[model samples]
Target: MRLVAAAVTFGAVLATLSGCGSDGPSGPVDAGGAQGRRAPGVTALPATDPTLIPDVGERLQRRIPADTGQVLVVYGEGENSPDSTAVFYMKEGPEWQRVARWAAHNGRKGWTVEHYSGDDRSPVGVFGLTDAGGVLDDPGSRLPYDQDYVAYAPTVNAVAYDHVFDYVIAIDYNRLPGTVPHNPTRPLGEDRGGGIWLHLDHGDGTSGCVSLPKGAMKFLLRTLDPAQHPVMVMGDERELRA
Candidate 1:
C-alpha cells in the first residue's frame, strides 16, 4: 500500500510540475512587510549574534508572546516564493540568541493569513509548537512522539514524501494540542486549514508546510523543549518585521 501510494504521489507531483494543472500553489507574488509592529517591553538587541540573517530578532521581539522563550523563525524570501530559512532561537538574559540555522522551504505560493486546505500557501503569524511524530523511532524528543505510518502518510509526491516524516514537529495551527500530531481532527473546520508542520525536506517545495533537511529535523526534535513554551514565528521577511 505504501508503495502504491508513493507511485501515485510521484506521478501527481511530476504532472503538477509539468503544468498539468492540479490546483497547486500558484498565487500572486508576495508583497511582504504587511505586518510589523515591535511589541512592548522588548529592548536591547542581542550582544552575540550567531547567524547572519538580518532583522529577525527585532521582528520577533514584536511578534512573539512575552512568555515564549523558544522560537523557530521560518523566514521566507518572499510571499510567493518556495524557498526560506529556518532559525531556532532561545531567549537569553534580555534578547534572543540564535541556536541553529538551516535552509528550508515553504509553500509553493508563499504565505497567507486566510489559508485553506490545498491552497499551497502557508499561514502567517505566530503559532505554538506542540505534538510531534515521525516514521522513525523517537529521537529523545521532549514532546509526545508518534511513530506510526498512519501518522506519517505520504500524501504528496511519494519521492517528496519519502522520509519526509522521518521527523516532524506539528505546528498548532487548527488542531488540538497534546494529541498525536497525525490526528485529523481540525478545530477550525477542514477547509479553514490544518496539519501545518515542520518536517524533513525533499529538496522541493511543499504543498503548504515547512520543510527542512532530515538532519535539521532531527536536531529540532531533540532541541524543542515543551517547558520553554516553543512557538513558530513564520512569514515573509517584511511581514515578519511588521
Candidate 2:
C-alpha cells in the first residue's frame, strides 16, 4: 500500500538526503590512534567457533538477540571513510554461516555512536531489520513491503539518486518497529535522528543509509526471513571490532 501523501513529501525526501527522513557518523581516522585499534575490554568470539563473525567484538556481539538467526554486517573501511563491505550471515544449527557478501557504502562522513540530524553518518550499533519498501514492486521480501513511488522518490539530485530507493530494508534505529520505512515517527525524539535503511547503492556514499548493489538488495529482499529475526550490525571496522 502507498504511504499517506501527507506523511511522505518532497520535503521528507530532502530531509533524508541530508540524513534525516527515512534513510539516514563520526570523524577522521587516526592511523596510529585508538580509531585504528580494536576497542579494549571487548572480547570477540573465538575464530575457531563457527558462529564467529570476524571483527565483531563483545559489546556489539552481545547486542545481537539470541533468537536472531540472520545478521548483516556493514564493515566500514575507516572512521572517516565512506567505503564499506556488507556480509550476510545466517545461523545454521549452532553455527552462523556466511550466505553472501557485497561491496557497499555508508554515510558520506562515516559512522558514529551518537548520530544526530544532518550528521551524514550512519549509526554504530546493532539494529533490527523489520521493514521493507521502495518505489518498485515487492520482490518477494519476507518483511512487510510498502510500495509508493511518490513517497519514495528523491527530491534532490534526482539524477544521482535515481533508482536508489527501488528497494529498501528499514534499519530499526530510533524508528518504530513494524512500520513503513518512510514513517516519520521517532520515539527517541527527532534530535536523535532516524530513517536509516539498507538501500540500492548509487555508486557512492549515502547521507546516512547503507547502500548496496541492486543485485545484493534484491538478494537480501528475497532471502532475509522474518522467522530468522534479522539484525544489522554496522560501524567502522575498528568500532565493530570493539
Candidate 3:
C-alpha cells in the first residue's frame, strides 16, 4: 500500500517567561579568583566530556554530522511497539542540552532498519531534516516551507485524519531533501517507501511517519532551524543502545 502524506497545522501560541536577577558575587571567591570560580553551588564539567547525545550508542552517535546543532531523538519502547518518546536537543558549545520532550507514536507495526513500502514500520537511523509543509499556512518555520492544501490533503478517513497534516517536517529518509514533504520523488526508488514525516498525532500510530502531539508539532515546526543542520536519530531503545 502506498503511504499517504500526513498533514499538520500550527497556530498555537506559546508563552515565554523571563526572569531578572542581580549580577554580584553571592559568596566568597576562591584562590583562582572570581573568573575561575563557579557560583556557590555550581559544578563544572571538563571540556572533554563526551556525552553529546545521551542514550545513543557509539555507532549511531557517530553518524551525526559534526556541524549539526539540533537533534531529535525518537526512542521506541520496543522493536514491535508503537509507543515512543521524542526528545529534542540543542548543541551548546561542546555539550548537547535537552530542549523538550513529548510522547509520540511511530509506525503501527513498530521500527525497522530495512524499511520498505507498506512495511508499517518507521525507519531507523540518522536522517537529515531539511523541508516542511502542510495543508495549512507556514507557522514561522526556519526551514523551507511548502503550503499546498490540494496536494497535502488527506485522501482517506477524512474525519479521522483531519488536521494531521496541519504541520509536517519532512524526514529525509528515502526521498530527495529540500523538497516539500508531499513530494513523491524518491531517489531510493518506490519500493523503499517515502513521504515519512514528523506530523501531528491522530491518537494512534502512522503508516510510516512519526506522530507527535499538536503542541509538540507546533513547537518543532517553529523551532527546528535549517541553519542548525538538524538531524533525527530514531529506533527502538535496544537498537539505539547498540
Candidate 4:
C-alpha cells in the first residue's frame, strides 16, 4: 500500500531532495508494462525513501553497515509487529533506496506507548513529518540543568534519567495526563511525551519514542525535508519488540 507522507512543509530548508521534483515520473504503468526512466542523480522509486532499519533483512545484521534515512516503511493495518513492517533509509549515494530493516516495538496490550509517563508499548498509526530535538544540546529551562536535549517534542516529558538517543517523538496512541495522549495530526507536547523526540538507546530504551541506533536517528532527523509532510507507518502485535 502507498504511504500518506507527513504534515510539515518547508520549501526553503536547503534540502538535497529529489523524489518530490515535478519532472519526476509517477502514476501506474502502461498496458505494455514499460520500465520507469530513472532520474539522473535520483533513481526511479515506488514512492518513499529506502534506508530505514526495519526495511533491511532478518535478524539484527543491519547495524554493522549502518545506513538509514530517506526510508520506506513497509506496513499496514492488522498488527504492528517488527516483521509486520519494513523500514527503509538512504544508502549508497543521493538516491533514496531500501537497505536496512527492523521489527518495530508496537503497543503490547492494555498499556499504550507514551513518552512522558505511561505504559511502554509503541503507538499504532500513521504519523506526520515531525520535528527533532536533542536533550544533549538543548537550551531549555526544565531538565537536569546540566542535561541537554534534542527531541521531536519542542516541549514535553519532565523526567530526566536518560533513555537512549538525544531525542524522542511522542507516539500518538495513549491516554496520558499532561500530553495530547494518542491522537493523530496533533502538535507535540499535546499531552506529555510531547517532548518525545527520536534519540539513541541508553539501555532502558524508550518510554514511547522510536528507539533506533544513534547514527540512524541522526540521519533521519536531518534527511527529513523540513518542508514536506513525511509519514510514519506503525502498529504492533505478537512477535513485535521481541
Per-residue C-alpha lDDT of model 3 across residues 109-160, encoded as one tens digit per residue: 9999999999999999999999998888886788899999887787567676
Name the regions of candidate 3 deviating beyond 4 angstroms. 1-50
What's the best-to-worst order under TM-score? 2, 3, 1, 4
Off by over 4 Å in 1: 1-63
Cα TM-score per model: 0.75, 0.80, 0.80, 0.41
Name the 10 consecutive residues with the lowest summed lDDT in model 1.
Answer: 26-35
Off by over 4 Å in 2: 1-46
Give the local distance difference test score of model 3. 0.73
Which candidate should be chosen as best, given TM-score against the real structure? 2
- Per-residue C-alpha lDDT of model 1 across residues 144-229, encoded as one tens digit per residue: 89989765877766675677888888988899998888788998899988889998878767888998766566656765677667
Order the numbered candidates by lDDT, best leading. Answer: 2, 3, 1, 4
Sliding window of 10 residues with minimal summed lDDT for model 2: 24-33
**lDDT for 125 (candidate 1):** 79
6-73 per-residue lDDT for model 4 (tens digits): 21211212133322223221111121111222211122234443333332223322322222223334
lDDT of all predictions, in order shown?
Answer: 0.69, 0.75, 0.73, 0.34
Preferred candidate (TM-score higher): 1 or 2: 2
